[model samples]
Target: MVDDTSLTSLPKCCLSVVIPCFNEVERIQQCIDRVLEQPVVGEV
Candidate 1:
């Protein structure tokens, strides 16, 4: 189980992963896949 103190120590900051595209229906899956595969190194 994750400790409450460790969770509370996390910084309050936004982690934005902007996927800018006009028509991203096809590429959206790939974008989401890549984003989800990435590990949260710092804030994200």
Candidate 2:
């Protein structure tokens, strides 16, 4: 799981997968520079 370390380090996350459900499609997309829903994924 990503934590404060991720922000501090500015890590590079991946989104190379195949989702089946349509409801959570937006959760993932083209992993550009910044991660897509960083705020959506609440803090631990």
Candidate 3:
């Protein structure tokens, strides 16, 4: 079994979003802006 104390001792984690697009020039900026607004999203 896993220890709860060990989990609590771990450092905070950040998340990165990866978006793959081919021809999203018109909406890419909008997508990026929305992702940046997220509290846990560090990079897109």
Best-fitting candidate, measured by lDDT?
3
Root-mean-square deviation of every model: 6.8, 10.6, 3.7
Q: Ranking under lDDT, best-scoring first?
A: 3, 1, 2
Per-residue CA lDDT of candidate 2, range 1-44, in tens?
Answer: 87886787865554443335457556435432134345443221
The C-alpha local distance difference test score for the whole of candidate 1 amounts to 0.74
How far out, in Å, is residue 44 in model 1?
10
Per-residue CA lDDT of candidate 3, range 8-38, in tens? 9889897767777679999889988989898
lDDT (Cα atoms) of all candidates against the true structure: 0.74, 0.46, 0.82
TM-score of each: 0.50, 0.19, 0.60
Error of 2 at 2 (Å): 11
Two-way lDDT contest, 1 vs 3, winner? 3
Deviation (Å) of 13 in candidate 2: 0.7
